[model samples]
Target: MQTLVLVAHPHLADSTTQQFFKASLPSTGVTYRALTAQETYDAAREQAALRQADRIIFQFPLYWYAAPASLAQWEAAVLTRTFVYGDHRYPLADKELGVVVTTGMPAQAFRRGGTENVTIDALMAPLAALAHRAHMTWLPTLAVHQFNYLDEAQKLQLVVDYQRYLTQPAPDTLANRQAWFADRLPAMVAQLAPADRATGELIVTTMTQQQDDLEALMATLAMIKEQDDD
Candidate 1:
């Protein structure tokens, strides 16, 4: 699946959070662009890119409960009525819309009694509404809270999590997670050094066994349930 990440930060060169995220992006099946890097946008061109993507992501830092001015500006110039819905083509329909927002505050702060006192979802209602208007599927937002506070392990985990968010199929389940890893394990093992390759191959073998065992157990349960229903 093709995924487009539109970054809306005014100073993309200086944001470590964004830089890290960019570094974590998979080499294939993903395209990224900084929306604010250019002075103006070509409405037709932007719409065409959006149409090509299976998943569209808006990545930015929140500014006063909304995306920065650049995002709004891009929306005004590119998201023309005729392109989105006026013609009734609904070009974005069946596509996925998602958000990746980085924040200075903690996750707990985005609650009724917390410091910000407003949930991230509430702040992002407009974008979700846009997805609804265009018949797009709105994905659950990926919120990064206080990036500077994360430790080494958390950062390592985020790499996998972010990659999955971009490429993994919807309704994230254990089976799907296994499938995603299994698909990449061969290439991943090939990239490792000779000394570490054995361990990588072992992990792949073990995971395959686990997957087969899990499937067998699930099929057994299904048969028992079917018999009970009879």
Candidate 2:
């Protein structure tokens, strides 16, 4: 699926979180548009980009509990009746709408009892409503909190997770997630040295064995239940 990432950052070049997140995405099937302070807004180009994408992601740093003015302007210019609504048609129908937001404070602060005193979902309600109005599917938001506090290992894992969020077909499902990793494991193992490749294969084998064993146990339980019913 084609993904269009619209980044609304006043100073995108300096943001560590946005840079890392953008770097994590694969080069193919993804388009990045950064709304910088100097660029003039082109409504036609923006509308064309939205029309081409199967998934549209709005990436931004949270400013005073909302996105920056650039995104609002883009919305006003592009999300008009001529392009998004009216005429008994919706250009964005069946498309996916996702948000990736970065926050200076900790994630815990977004909850009811915390500093922000509101859930992230609550804060993103306007975007969700926009998606609904546009006939787009509203995806779960990826919120990066206290980004400066994360260690190297944590950041690495975050990249992997964020990449999956952007590219995976069924990111929220365990079976699809396992399949996605399994599909990548072989190519990843091929890139390793001889000894590392051997170790990687061994790990994959062990995981496969465990999965088989669990499936067998489930089958046995089902048979036992069938006999009890008889």
Candidate 3:
């Protein structure tokens, strides 16, 4: 189950931040492929990667409130109905998909009524929906907001965090998070220390924050699809 990192920056040669992030990633058993050099998105390469991967990550900087042009083009050209749908509607089912993005604007700028007037999550709705339809587990987006403002130490920390975030197992989805924990309580019980067990209740309670986020996105996508259907 190889993890495929699909990098989609048009001008990788000129990108400092993205290049640094790419170079920092550990290559042990991980497949890193770029979608830039081919005269067009190569379906054979895309399918081969998909066939061999257990996780697929879309890494890019946001462009026009979305992914780089190459990513959008790859999606349009590679994710065909026959391969991604038709018989294999869930081509990547039970697999993981995440977006790793670097933004020029400060993190605070994306808050509601802030400079961008929308959150990062809002801006990434299309990818979230794509994850759902493809049946790939969607993870919390990893964002490098204000990549230019971070100091050397901070940049190093961000690199480690980004690497960890990309490699970690997919976060529990809202539709299944509670049920998953409930079923795992027996296994989790033996690991809980006396003092830790007392605090464990807080862990379950706080997970609702993640659930609220997933539910909101799912509901929003549902409405969007409904409008499209009409």
Candidate 4:
């Protein structure tokens, strides 16, 4: 998938969480744009990037219950009516729009009677509305709450989770997960150091067996369903 990550952070250089995410990005099939780093807005270029991306991610730290001002400005400048819907082209139709928002507080803080007194989803209503209007698929927001407090294991797990979020297909089913890893297994194994290459190959073989077993079970289930229908 062609993923576009638009980052809006006023002090990106100082943000450890943001830096970590940047380092964790997949090496291919993704484009990164820092909104604040740009000298000026280019509506046509921005729109072109959006059109080319199969999945677009708006990455930013929450500010006053919303994204940073640059994101809002970028939205205003690029999401013109003629481009989105005025001419009824719907260039973004069926594409996915996701958010990767980092919050200072814990997940629980963004709930009724909690510290923030509002859900993350509630704060992101405007962006969701935009996706709806454009007929694009609205992905569930990926919120990183209190990144500084996460343990090393959690951070390591986030690397894989975040990568999958960008490239893995929607519905997040087991079969899809298997297929995704399966597709990448060869390249992943090839990149392993010689000492570890054997282990990587073994993992690929094991996963392949598991996938075949899962497919066989699914086929049996489908046959049972058909029999019941008859």
> What lDDT would each prediction earn against the true structure?
0.93, 0.85, 0.77, 0.92
Which sections of candidate 1 miss by over 4 Å?
215-230
Tens digits of per-residue lDDT for model 3 on 1-230? 46788888989878888878878785455788777745486687778778788878889888867898888788888888777766756667778888888889988989988989899999989989888887878878888887778899999888667656555445644465455444445456557987887577566656656677867889999899999995
Model 2 stretches astray by more than 4 angstroms: 205-230
Estimate the TM-score of every prediction.
0.91, 0.86, 0.71, 0.90
Question: Across residues 1-230, which tens digit of lDDT does each residue of candidate 1 receive?
Answer: 99999999989889999999999998899999898746689898999999999999999999887999899999999998988998688999999999999999999999999999999999999999999999999999999999989999999999998999899887677788899989999999999999999999999999999998998898898899999995
lDDT ranking, best first: 1, 4, 2, 3
Highest TM-score scorer: 1
Clash count list over all predictions: 0, 0, 0, 0
RMSD of each: 3.3, 4.3, 9.6, 3.5
Winning candidate number (lDDT) = 1
Model 4: residues >4 Å from true position, as ranges? Answer: 215-230
Error of 4 at 11 (Å): 0.8
**lDDT tens digits by residue: candidate 2, 1-230:** 89999899998879888888878887568898888655666778888889999999999988999988888878877788778778868999989999999899898999989999998899899999999988999989999998899999999889888877777775476556766677677878898999799999987778667776866787898899999995
| Model 3 collision count | 0
**Candidates ranked by TM-score, best first?**
1, 4, 2, 3
Better of 2 and 4 by lDDT: 4
